[model samples]
Target: METNSKETLQADFDVFDISEEFGFLLEEPLTHLPDHYQVWLDLANNLIHLIESRKLRDLVDKMPVLSPDLLSDHRELRLAHLALGFISMGYVWQEGQHAPAEILPKALALPFWLVSRRLGLPPILTYADSVLANWKLKDPTGDMRIGNMDLIFSFPGGDTCRGFFIVSLLVEMAASPGIMGALEVMRAIKVSDLTGIKNGLIKVTQSLKKMKEKFKFMHNHVEPAAFHGKLRIFVSGWRDNPMLPRGVMYEGVSDEPILLSGGSAAQSSAIQCFDALLCIQHEEETGAFLTRMRDYMPPAHRQLIETLSVCPPLRDFILSCSNSDLCQAYNSCVSALVDLRNYHLNTVTKYVIIPGNHAQSVGCPFRGVGTALNTTGTGGSNLMVFLKSVRNTTQKALILERLS
Candidate 1:
């Protein structure tokens, strides 16, 4: 018997108020807030310049604290968050990782906190802000290829910074179809449609393969050396960091300092969406860390993951049905996801672990948001261990096909 109606499952997805066309991405993010918030727009637009001149702090310190209520729409509020996030990161680390600012000035902190709270995000740079909502179509009518896309704001690291953020955006873009496929699989499961389930899973595997191809382009644009020392620090958050033992004080928002995880690919909702729909189970520790990363995502995206988690168990269905075709389809989806994670693991080793190890060997060790590599992720997990656990758990989801 079918356990749920298609309409009921869809109602859950609709309640989150996400766009049908763009999935979790803020479609056509506002390039500028309204004129009253011009001060913020100005700061964000010229952020790289201000940081380069060591003038970002002076200007942010003197700027007026704006009310987030002034922003009228979802897109405006998101841009406000992204703008403030970029500015805050630049402000804190302006003097380099060794001398991060102990307090975020009220001009940036108060508004950032209010905006972040309203949006159900932490007041720091996150994958949602930097990658999902941080892009624009250069030609407006063109495809979202790297050459046709551009970043709305950035820190230092020049072309490398541009490459890193844009490629991450492209990865999200590549995952859109997989998101749709997951939705279709859920709908199919509600109706107990075997053909629908198998076809949907095939779509998912194909989408993941495309995502992997797009992810590999990171090497073409961002060099590992530049990413480790120069660009990585800007997106790092306050929690579990060695440098700021007490965390960051947001001048007017709270009397006590606040702790938050830095930006990480782990925060991206795309992969989590897959994990939930496929019913891939993780061990307790790995599962908890993933759940924590969800807090760093936009509220709607987080809710989507939660909703899918409680859906009818797809893995159990494949096992009980004893259908060879369905089992193979399900296994292929898991394998593609595993392949993507494997590539990501390799990329992290090259970009963070290898570079960080060499720096330590030369008598210099990194501190702050991340340490000498293996100890932490930008999201604060024990880097390689957490990733390996996740990949292995995903591999375990494959069911043995029973021959008819």
Candidate 2:
């Protein structure tokens, strides 16, 4: 009966032609998805089982390195890599451990890194660190507690807190469309197909603009007090019996911690990819301002962004070709980007600065808000100014002036 039931559970996967395009992780109501997506559903569920059982490490090392090209073509493959990374952290970060998480071998880490970026997923480490690895207790006197002239509140964080894993699911759900769109954009760029590139960038620009609009929900719709209260309940049993994250994790003595430097900086990298690809250079302090923000991203992604930044911008490459039509397209793309960044600036004000004022975690290492600048210091505008600088420099970028 046991074997039969287990077989029946996964048997559903075999008949359904599972593929990544189905958006497995983001989909709700597992039973509602067509048979074509069931393969990944099983895989995703299995990964969940592994984490919940505290057995992720047993097979995490055995997971294979998949081609990003292949993963890009198939969302299931990407989903597998994502689940594996999440599972590893669930175990390695462990319950009750405060030290650094064990090193995720470059072999295991690299595939996830590539797959995630291509899929429009931000760095997994940042997702885990901000949402999972952090914790704060509710206390009138607790440092993290938000108290004002009238109200005080707290959130789930640290050990037993499922905030990281739980909230990350939502973030991924929110971000998956953008990630897929970026992958399409990169594909268009590779062929130097101007039309495809224009469409792709437009798609992403709109999506990003939408993302900024959604930031309003963080403030206007639910707000913090009721938001945190309800969320804690949703994640209530996470530590007791292990639920959304799969299970409780224990650290292994032999595992040494690997630190990922980022909390806010990773958010910037997504935007930086546009500049790097466009070869739009920032002048002096303006450029310096953005460079400094790179520290907030995971070291691997920071390295990736730095490498891309030094490459000749797209306009420089196109100018060498002397293709006017393509140049115009490039200019349009940059304008769209500027519009997108303008939206981002407003989001920073809403999500980061406002929350920071209310005692939420923001600023500095964690760029949700400007910590030092939260008090109106010099560096806070590092992010705000960078966005403005990009917009201001648009006409000066490669061929944008002629178009303007």
Candidate 3:
């Protein structure tokens, strides 16, 4: 990474601190941050406070009815997306284990649903519950994706959102032991003892294969309403649009106008973190492709990924090696990663290609498709760069070992 990029990534850390915002909730955990991560944090904070302090009916009265004209530089409608998502998340998560599931008051629920319908956002895709926006951890010892993603859950169709994140969490967590084992194997690597290294690679490959299956299960079971729809007005400009609301400018600000908008790709920063753990690197010269995709993730998470990219375990595996068994193990690992990448490509196909929902109303990223082999975010799942990098690195090892 370049020095400037290093500095940029360091800024991508997690932001939710319990006592700072909503420590007063009677019980239960404060699982996410307030939405509207725009230019003004106050805008986001104030809107959430309003939702918490006011009666549901009063709040509803103030909100404008859903309409296309309402989207013209409308801060109220934008903040409402955040306000409702935050309130509903809080309402749902406030009670802890015994909390009522699906029990939001009609005042907040009805309008939120109506607005979400207008925006092409599912209730699950809101800032609070979105895999893109709300996923973060209180602490990560190392490798953010290895142990923490405390927030990023995908809801099942009809069931309550309770078990939603856990399924994805399980898939990610299944790789933890394999990663540590691979690390252990890397540390013990020698010309003679290929046994531990090969075993470790096999385990990692198996786990990824299982992860692929899980993704398929997730894709198959996903309710059409969840990923299938037109994108909301706020996100209509997502990655393709150069325009920002009405007057939001690009020059004076540190981030692009889209970064500040509710529809920006930064909302899905966690997915970028996932790509990093799997060793995905994008093309630098490509404009707004994977080259700068990491910019969409939080600066803090980007830092963590950068730190891990150079860590001894994963870094050492790719540096140089001449052991035939080690090379074989790495080749198998590459195959497994390719399998997962193929699965991601298929995921894009299901959402974008097969179903053919890539239109604007289909909502920001879900509408676009990117391949999983080389580039990213073109049309489907954004796992391609990572997949390609891992394969290239391992293939290099195979060549070096054969040459020796």
Best by lDDT: 1
Question: What local distance difference test score does each model get?
Answer: 0.84, 0.42, 0.39
Q: What TM-score, over all chains together, does every model reach?
A: 0.93, 0.42, 0.46
lDDT of 2 by residue, 84-148 (tens): 44444443433312222335544355655565555444334333233322223344354321121
Reference-based TM-score, model 2: 0.42
Any runs in candidate 2 off by more than 4 Å, and if so which? 1-128, 131-192, 221-262, 265-269, 283-312, 320-328, 351-398
TM-score-sorted candidate list, best first: 1, 3, 2
Q: What alpha-carbon RMSD in Å does predicted model 3 have with respect to the real structure? A: 13.7
**Against the hidden true structure, what lDDT does model 3 obtain?**
0.39
lDDT of 1 by residue, 1-404 (tens): 34565565457557655554566677898898778899998998998899878899999989997888888778888999999999988888887667889899998999999999888999998899998899998899898778998899987778889999998877887787788788788878888899989988998899899989989899999987677777887887788777666889999989999888889988989899999988989999989888999999988788878877998999988888888898899999999999998999998898889888776676654442234333678787888998899999999887754645
Name the lDDT value of residue 16 in candidate 3: 16
lDDT of 1 at 68: 80
Tens digit per residue, CA lDDT, model 3, 156-195:
2222122234344444445444444443343345332457
What RMSD, rounded to one decimal, does every model reach? Answer: 2.9, 15.1, 13.7
